[model samples]
Target chain A: MDRATTETKLINGYQHEFPLVPRPFQRIGESLGMDEDEVLALLRDLQDRGALARIGAVVSPRTIGTSTLAAMTVPPDRLEDVAALVSAFPEVNHNYEREHDINLWFVVAAPSENDVATVLHNIERRTGLEVIGLPMLDSYHIDLGFRLPCG
Target chain B: MNRIAPSPAIDDLDRRIVKATQSGLPLVPRPYHALAETLGVTPEQIMDRMRRLLAKGIIRRIGAVPNHYRLGYTANGMSVWDVDDAAVAETGAAMGQLDFVSHCYHRPRQLPIWPYNLFAMVHGRSREEVEAKVKKIAALLGDREDGHDILYSTRILKKTGLRLVD
Candidate 1:
């Protein structure tokens, strides 16, 4: 794959304005002087290369109910076992570890405040480890999108 | 010619639709209708197209994005776990069952630089409360429990939709 082509087709493709039509991508292609297939191919290529994770809605959970960010500290050898236990819950939307002792981190979303508590409790019982439940008390901004410069 | 199903092409219009609805469906009474008017298409068309996008997997989900801080909770932590590959699916399912866990998934262990694989986010009102929960999770996984960490979000730089092209 041509790095220049990938970068041109994808990085440059990000800045294009969004169309406000039923077939918005079609219009977008027209503006870019490329067909819909060309635009999509570029996106797929990016995904294959791991540049783009997935294109999806970034909806706020607060509008629906309650949520939180919780983490834990597990023994180095038991990392795999603990992660498997933590990921078993359906409410967890995003989970990642960082360079720290308390590494197991995850996000839990529930329909209500009580549900969050119950989920935490369940994790505790199932995993036999204290599952920390850190509900978000404030949010500065919840948008994760970024505009990559076209090189 | 032997043919493989080519990925669905995302045209400019699709990107626009995603951008429009990415943030959310308008809070107005006739949000879909309003969007249709703006897009110069019928509301039915917009709805149908959205449905198609969902089916195509281009759009993972269409729902509300909550602001937890505004709702009276603030402490947020990213919990990472190193789970056995065979048990990851099972463990992830268990973690997903928790209502407090908003996000959970299995990521490859990057080793050295990044070792933790399975990850989840837990939110709470206070650090103590969050810590209390973590203690409980440690006991649940038993022998499989490995080193874990709590990388609290000191500052949220950006959290929004994934721009496909960029």
Candidate 2:
């Protein structure tokens, strides 16, 4: 197969149900008609090129610990500073600037609910902005839905 | 996943395994064996633990997580809907069934200032595509869709997976 086709197959085919055996890359290599080293190299290259985050497990949120989607409205001028402050917290994982009155949005994952609360409270105290905590009451999707389009 | 049950059953070994592989699995020929050596456990034990984690839904899936940005999915929108509280479960489930809706959650509605209870993350190559997908969600919601807004991510300030501390 060509390089493009090989990459497309590697990414699209193994997004889910990746081989669970001890030699998973070898298993994947067998399926993709490549050697174990080839599969590993391709994956490493993808990671280096910023195409692949990692060949790992996507853990379910709030399963082991607690997490919440929190948002804050930061002044446009202070958005960068506030975002830096929010992102500085190790508990804060995902942070984004959305186009809304409540512009600063983030996800805080901690060992416990109290830890999550503390992280949010610290953000509130530091940024001096009220943080709206929106914990997932119920999830409707079946896992992080199949993403990444086949090109 | 549909049932987001809080499983308080995860133990120390499980957390260790999670910490070891949360960022990404080893890219070696024998990844499990590598994990086993590092965690001071047998390869069989590591594999067994991973299998159980998978069955228990603790590990959603073990695979490649692609970077959507690199794949040209530039427009990321968080579509929030103020639907009838009573009908939220039904509508949210239906919205999640769509191939385009990656994440759908029914969260609490902060009165007055914030009223959206249903949140679905939609991604597209452009704003128009994302808006069109959001329109489909609106159609699905029908009368239950009291109000809605799409919060397009202007910038990705930070994006990283969960990191458990010792």
Candidate 3:
């Protein structure tokens, strides 16, 4: 696809969504004055071009139960082994090695605070690395949505 | 491919609106009106501010949060890729476009052992599905020899909004 076509499709995909109904994509197509297949095709093309991610639900961690941000300082040599060990669990949502001494940071979510504690304890025991738990004490604002251009 | 620019920052009132709407807004037909009431502002004002926020990129999106496990999306993984410094952002933006990928970003790579710089979150109904997606991503990036790890979440401790103090 050419630059103009790619940009147009990207903007449309980002701005348009299927209405909440059976065959919602058809409704979206109606609004865009395009066929349902065409809308679906554009969505697939946008996904292929890396202009949009998955169209799925984003859930709240607190409402579900509990979740926390945890970190550890793994030795350079043992980083991979320790990361693999930590990644073995299913509760970790996302993990990264920040540019800090306390490098390895990961988020854990569970059905309850107690469950999170259990997971943390398991990681400590299994990895033999001290786990520092930073459970969110307060929440200010959390929204992942962002519009494209600033006007 | 040209890089996507960083989003613009939030203004004061925009911050206030966001600070109010962070924890899931009240589920109602007139949710925006309710929010306006809480802020002692008109519904129109709230709507306008939100429109501006969206345009300015202060909030990436406003949508529903599905219970993944309840929906049978039980197996999820965070696949971090060790892309070169020059390609991290481009690769990340590309990865973020995947339908199954819930979240993606670029982070500094740690030395010695930790080298992965790109992170992508993939969700699926089963472990096999998640693994398959990761494998496809690895191939797409042409980083067959790159180091990566799939960290499955074991527990959820605390999930909430980031407080922006003005």
lDDT of 3: 0.59
Question: Model 3 reaches what TM-score against the true structure?
Answer: 0.54
**Candidate achieving the largest DockQ:** 2
lDDT string for model 1 (A35-90, tens) is: 76665665556556645544335434343345666667767688777777766666
Task: Note the DockQ of each predicted structure.
Answer: 0.05, 0.78, 0.05
Q: What does the interface RMSD come to for each candidate? A: 16.3, 1.5, 12.1
- What class would a CAPRI assessor give candidate 2's docking? medium
> What lDDT is reached at residue B126 by model 1?
79
Q: Highest lDDT among the candidates is held by which one?
A: 2
lDDT for each residue of candidate 2 in A1-151, tens digit (9 for 90 to 100)? 9887888888888988888788998898999999999989999999999988888888898888889999998989999899999998888889999999999999999988898899999888987889999999999986653555555
Q: Tens-digit lDDT track for model 3 on B1-166?
A: 2222332444567656766775545433346667778888887787677666555544445443333544356575767777877766567667776666766755555465457666677877687999999988888888533677777655433323332322
For candidate 3, the clash count comes to 31
The regions of model 1 sitting more than 4 angstroms off are A1-151, B1-12, B55-58, B164-166
Candidate order by decreasing DockQ: 2, 3, 1
Q: Report fnat, model 2.
A: 0.86
lDDT of 2 by residue, B1-166 (tens): 3767875598889989999998888888888899999999999998888899989989888888988888788898999999888898899889988999888999998877799999999999999999999998888778888889999998888988766754
Superposed model 2: Cα runs more than 4 Å off: none
Worst 10 residues of 3 chain A by lDDT: A138-147
TM-score of chain B taken alone, candidate 2: 0.95
The predicted structure with the larger DockQ, 2 or 3, is 2
